[model samples]
Target chain A: MKTATFLNRDEFLNHWQGHRKLTRRTIEKFPEEEFFTFSIGGMRTFGELVKELLTISVPGLEGIVNKDDKPFSHDIELADKAAALKMWDEQTEQINELYNKISDEELYETFNLFGQYKDQTNNNLMYFHDNEIHHRAQGFVYLRALGIEPPFFWER
Target chain B: MKTATFLNRDEFLNHWQGHRKLTRRTIEKFPEEEFFTFSIGGMRTFGELVKELLTISVPGLEGIVNKDDKPFSHDIELADKAAALKMWDEQTEQINELYNKISDEELYETFNLFGQYKDQTNNNLMYFHDNEIHHRAQGFVYLRALGIEPPFFWER
Candidate 1:
């Protein structure tokens, strides 16, 4: 069974960054009130969605790099949308720093991600990406529900 | 510039297959009419979103394996939701066939995807996965708007 090389480190990081850019734009387009309160059919608001992304990426990566099995938790409470964005930027930098610690060899070695998802380091990274896009798409819907056009998906 | 190695071929394929399973579940959750007609904020309906995914993956992989540079086009005319699912399954088979042709050595080689988006074969493949997640997210939103609960995001 040959394993596929879907992305190298820099390319994967760039891919993640592109999605983050589009996600940030989605966050910006939300009206402050809707950011926290809007929901269609009992789904979470865009703010909550953004918080989920923030929670997963930084801590997940930290655990991967440190090999520390801290059960995943979003204990760090963000005050509001502004705080979320600031933390997003901070995590982006943190990702760069910690991501560098992962060598090409280590990417193939399986690690228990967040003490749960045991897969190759690279697969775990892709999970972070897939998770973000899933949430961001929800944000896109929230924008549309509010009669706002989202930044073009391709713009990322 | 450090490059990352994530999943080998089998792992990457499995990861993609998992997402496809979740996406298929999302499509199934949509009420037949809502799947085609429902939209939030003037966005493309779920049917059209599926069309975009169908348009890209198989052809993109075909081009990568064949080194064929044909401009991107949605030549397959899907008549309705059922037709889209049939085609979706067809493309899934097509992906397996074409994907198997791509040797690990070729994974690092750059391919011009859809006659644009020049990148390594691996990155191009990731684009396919990312684009699917982006569009599928929209479908999830559509489901929620229609008062339908989408499949769990982590179910993949």
Candidate 2:
């Protein structure tokens, strides 16, 4: 397989961090009541969606770095938007700490991420970022459905 | 700034191509009438959102490789979703060809993408992927609202 041009690790992390900041703001924009209860067309509530993101990201990266073979779990327990926001903050730090442990060579090594989705380490890392954007976009739609303005997509 | 471990060029392109495939499937899942007309809480219709994705991606990438300083234009002329999908196929080819023109060194070079976002070429490229996922999430919400099932998020 031909190696393609790629962003250096810090650049990738910076890009991920930018999206994370935007997602955090999206969570902040949700109304307290709707955050946990709102749903569109039988989709999960915004809070549940956030829980999925929270579960996948930090633990996912930790698994990648540690070579841990845990199956993916959506088991985060949070009572309110505040607790979720706090967890988001903690994950932000965890990402910074764990991300540095990965070396450039390791990025090309294949890892069975979350005990599934075997791919190059870099691809798995991108999944963490991609998954957040996927769910956050749902939160964006939810905000609109509730007649609230979402923070600008470019604000991050 | 420290360089972080990152995907090789081919890996990044492959990752992007996978997401594009899923997004195309998302577009196909939309009901034609709803594709152009449906919205929740005044968000842009799914067709319009797809339009934004189509407009930004290939043109933005073209600018990056050519060193063109064109400001962003949402001026893509498409009569409907079918036309949009045809253009998407063309752009998919365009991405494969143009992507290779961007050497690894070019990924780190800063360019004024869309004449607005001034960042490393790689980050700008990421903005393309991130923006597509964001809008496609909106399409997912629209599909649910119309009682249609979207393509699975991980299917890409």
Candidate 3:
């Protein structure tokens, strides 16, 4: 895991947060009724998808930070969209907290997420950054389907 | 936007298939009875997630190439997993066909996808790559839950 060093932590956080803000804006524009409605078959309603995004990142990043592949619990449920949003806000704060704890050297270290796919200890951290952009695209579509315009994607 | 050089088209296809193969392998490692039953609450069932992944990348990529943001109309009745998988396979083939038509230069052009989100066309391509890796992380955990070891993430 040589350095995936194009951007330092601060720069990465800025871009990451910028994109998430766009995602949040997209979430904001949706009609509340369709929040839980799946637009296409097998797709979670926009609300369900948003809730899933909130759970994955902070916990996912925690896994990356410690390089510890923690077992995901079955109890990872949100009561409602409001609860999900509160969870999201809390997770955002956690991201700010956890990200600052990482050293520049740590980002380049191989992350051993064990008992699952990826045995390598050396891994590029940028995969996480890139993954968020990917999910946000799905978010982009939900915005359009709701007849709202998504914020400019390249503002970051 | 600067040139967003990535895995070549062939490289991209190979990696895409490779990831899917590993994903299927992970899915298979689980008992058949649990395939449709598994869930991490806010997360999707492995069966459901795989079906949806099949829908997003290929069709999503194809839409980007044609600059047509066609939502999956047939999936409107999408509660069934089998139908979703069929749509997934068709979309995969469609992606392979459309992806072949994309020249190296077209990767970087400005793409007005539905006239909403716009960016250097090259970065748009990278979004396709990044999104899959992100979702695949969840699959890895689903694998672990069923006592399966997923393939190395960077087997590419």
Candidate 4:
């Protein structure tokens, strides 16, 4: 029996990119000092969360494309919001390039991600979206608490 | 020209239900008192957030299915965690029922959600997923802050 396909490769790319656009705006909304330092209820700062996203997207896609099982790392750092946005823009491009390298057929193939999580390529890809949205939502709450209005969620 | 389909109806339903399952687990992990009263940085309690979810899912879908453009409401209240879970389970079933009433072709039809937000049925459906994941992520932060280990996200 043939497995059902959810999103065609292009659809997935467009959808993921839309989410990235919104998340990028979310990152920009933060003040430099607060972006890295603010937290509510002992949650990590939004910058730390953003760092995890930056670490995941391009690196995770590259791992899938290169068949590398490197350990997960959030070791990268940025000097300020400007540096972080620059890296985000760069990885947005890299994600597109690396994502296209994997054919539609490959989406179903199982692969180990970050030498720890193993799942089909499609699930791993979905996880990328899930992880980013999870952190971005936290950023939303942070913005609200800080008395800043976040960009509309449906804009993406 | 034919528009590209992202997810088939069943695929969308299954993906959505998976999110619902994980969200239910997140609700389950909260202590009854904290679920309603505990919040950080002026964020609403997880219980309030869950009430919003409860309000949106069934009523929103009912709007879609019946072509009823009702105003958005988060007025529904539950007495305890048990009551919330019971409502969630009932809505889970209602979502399945109401979702099936929309054929694959109708997924492209535009509807004004809660008589305010208007978009294609497909996008509105996606918003359901997006909204849940967004709040659930907040719930995750709440859980961590309360020294609770929330369920693994990937389980869904």
Candidate 5:
């Protein structure tokens, strides 16, 4: 039997944070007035999507670290991009905090996410990363539709 | 120094293939006419986006595997969804072939991708995976806007 490791937990965290940084930039590029109202093809406004991200990260990590299960919610009132950016920064710190508390031994444990999705701790973390990338890509399209060039995808 | 390993080379390939499966399903769900035309927020149509993915994966892998750098191009004529899906399946096979050729020793070496964008072989591979996730996410938004429920993001 043989095993290989591409990246450690720390690298995974850094990669996730890189995506977060990119998402924050996407938030900065968005127009404040259109943040809540704009939608193309009936998709949720970027504001709604950003709010959902804000709702998830810290709360999700807290659930994993404290062994608590709570149903998922995306009902945060991010009145404007400024408020959203402020919380985004806060959650970034909270992620760093909660993420470090989970021992490596716990990395593979199955923790019920939002009392719903069940997966290893690592998969849940990947979900957070992937979900942000997914939404941020949509935001890129939204930005493009508004004739704005998004921050380079590779810059992160 | 402490080092931790999360996943091996084979797992990364499997994860990437999972996303491809999901993206194929996305193409299946799209209306035939809209495959080339449907878009939200001035973004490229799902057809156009899919073509770009097609353009990158196999050619990009071939470049890395054979050490041949060709400029990137997405001008392939995919007449319709059927043609596109067929080519996609073919490319998926090609990716498996090309991906396996590169030794683990070469994984961290930088290769000029498409005659531009130099990064570690692993990072380029990640770019392929992340690029697909990014585009597929945009497709997800396009689907929702069309009142179509996309294949579950997690199902892949």
Candidate 6:
């Protein structure tokens, strides 16, 4: 078997797209009320984590596209889920917009992330999807705790 | 002002339990058939991802617990979700087991993770929990695509 790697731009984008779709599904699984409820000490609430999903991408992508690394502040405290949902939708659009703006030459170059960690642009890009994948897993556990069934892992 | 810091053994374990409680919830959300499906190329299906999760921990912890770096080959494969869950439960036990075995000196010293990366045993130990957080996010997206509402994000 050949080495399994994501080398081309389209291939990478497909995975990212799939991830965005999957995260949207995670949002659907929540009742919306408890989606943002805080549980464990120091662990973020579902709503809070979802808020990070909304904020991190736009700013993070804006940073990556401009080659400037800035902190993506996470704010899950909101009066309503609709606003959070709307923000998440807009960021989703921004991710794709800024994403296509990146040049292949820049992809491999190291960029600073939140003033720490010398990050590779490609890896940072992957982190976009990878970070979502990380947080959505927490979403899954929350679903099960509510006795709700989440979607298939690979459906996206 | 407060300090941002790394987790200690007990802190890490609580995080693990918190993650695990959520993971099982995420798994419950998905249909078993698609658990291993990778909607995009180069991305592991959720099933394959689960297997990886099951296998990574013991070797990672054993590296610290036993002072050895073991590869992914072992009697257990993280691929089996139920088995992975079982193994994960077992590994958590093993983590507890190793926790008792390690000296304070060992906990503070650097440990190699199958040549993946090297850090203090404390960090590597925490890596185990970080891994779970990363993958669970994928589960969230999957659930959303299925049009299933997962439980609250903060149930644990």
TM-score of 5: 0.91
Best candidate, DockQ-wise? 2
Misplaced by over 4 Å in model 3 are: A1-4, A73-75, A117-124, B1-156
Q: What is the C-alpha RMSD of each candidate to the true structure, in Å?
A: 2.1, 1.6, 10.3, 2.8, 2.2, 14.2
| DockQ winner between candidates 3 and 4 | 4
Compose the digit string of candidate 2's lDDT tens values, residues A12-125.
787889889999999999999998899999999999989998888888878988999798778778999999999999989999989888777878888888787788888778
lDDT scores of the candidates, listed in order: 0.82, 0.86, 0.56, 0.83, 0.84, 0.63
Model 1, A21-130: lDDT tens per residue? 88888887888887888998888877877877888898888888899877887556777878888888888789888988887887878898888899888878888888
lDDT of 5 by residue, B33-146 (tens): 788888765678999999999999998988999899889899988899999999999988898888888887678688998989788887788778888999998888788778
User: In CAPRI terms, where does candidate 1 land?
Assistant: medium
For model 4, the superposed segments whose C-alpha errors exceed 4 Å read: A1-7, B1-8
User: Backbone clashes in each candidate structure, one number apiece?
Assistant: 11, 6, 5, 0, 0, 33
DockQ, every prediction? 0.68, 0.73, 0.05, 0.37, 0.54, 0.08
| Model 6 TM | 0.51
Residues forming the 10-long window of minimal summed lDDT in candidate 1 chain A: A2-11
For model 3, how does the per-residue alpha-carbon lDDT over A64-102 read when each residue is reduced to its tens digit? 677678754424666555665677678778988876766
Residues B5-67, candidate 4: write the lDDT tens digits.
334567668878999999999999998888889886687899999999888888888898889
lDDT of 6 by residue, A1-156 (tens): 111121245545655667677778878777777866733323567787777777767777788777676776775466666776677677767776787787766665678865564666665565556467777776766676566887776566
lDDT of 1 by residue, B80-111 (tens): 77888787788778888899899888888877
Candidates ranked, most accurate by DockQ first: 2, 1, 5, 4, 6, 3
Residues A1-156, candidate 5, lDDT per residue (tens digit)? Answer: 224555567767777888899999999999888899988778789999998898888999999999999887898677899999999998888998898888887777888988997988877877787788898998998898787889988777
What TM-score does chain B get in every candidate? 0.93, 0.95, 0.69, 0.95, 0.96, 0.81
